[model samples]
Target: MSLQSSNDGPLDFVKYQNVVDGKLVASSNGETYHNINPSTLETNPEVPLSASDDVDKAVIAAQKAAESWAKVPWDERKKRLMDFADALEAHTEAFSQMLVKGNGRPPLHQKIIYDKLI
Candidate 1:
């Protein structure tokens, strides 16, 4: 099954952006590496290996965000976390499918991840 977006072109399904703070960003060096599946030996060509600079940027962003995000009330944080949990539960099927495709894991195994988060 393909993930289609009307406005955007077809997903490259290759490159994965680095998660900086909470947003995805490209590598500074524009360098990328391939990840091979041990079982099938199928190489995923599009996944960009994040550069070290991305890690530094992500850490800085998280530090900045944490300063403000931590100031919020504990109750509010708990509520938001719970909401996120609920959203994950509601989107279990889609989440599992994405996980299986990216991770090359069986659907049954993906349930373990969701269970662990719960």
Candidate 2:
């Protein structure tokens, strides 16, 4: 899918929404917590927090997917994995920037990502 910019795009932190039990649901308590930026000391609004129950559901769904994913024809799995890798490459630049900003990692980490593209 071609990437399209929407006012709503990156604003949603819970992108996948913590898929649980093959079902998606908002936080049971509708709770959230702030994620502060350490460097700028900026506070981002509380994103929804996934409760333990949600985690269990996610695990069960993953387990179910893995069982089928594992049994998939090996060639098909390899092709799908390659597609995922390509998608990652497409976003590597943004990912590195986000990583540095979020983790305060050394500048070299970005260089490492660039080098990998070689």
Candidates' C-alpha lDDT: 0.68, 0.62
Instruction: Give per-residue CA lDDT, model 1, range 3-91, as digits (tens).
Output: 32233543444557766666566688787777665446677565556677777887898899889889989999899788777766766
TM-score of candidate 1 versus the correct structure, residues matched by position: 0.69
Question: Model 2, range 15-108, lDDT digits (tens) per residue?
Answer: 3243455455667768776666565666644555988876777778889889988999999999878776776666566666555555556658
lDDT of model 2 at position 63: 90
Off by over 4 Å in 1: 1-15, 102-104
Best by TM-score: 1
Each candidate structure's TM-score, on Cα atoms with residue i matched to residue i, is 0.69, 0.68
Model 2 / residue 28 / CA error / Å: 2.7
Among all candidates shown, the one with the greatest lDDT: 1
Q: Which stretches of candidate 2 lie over 4 Å from their true place?
A: 1-16, 21-25, 106-108, 111-118
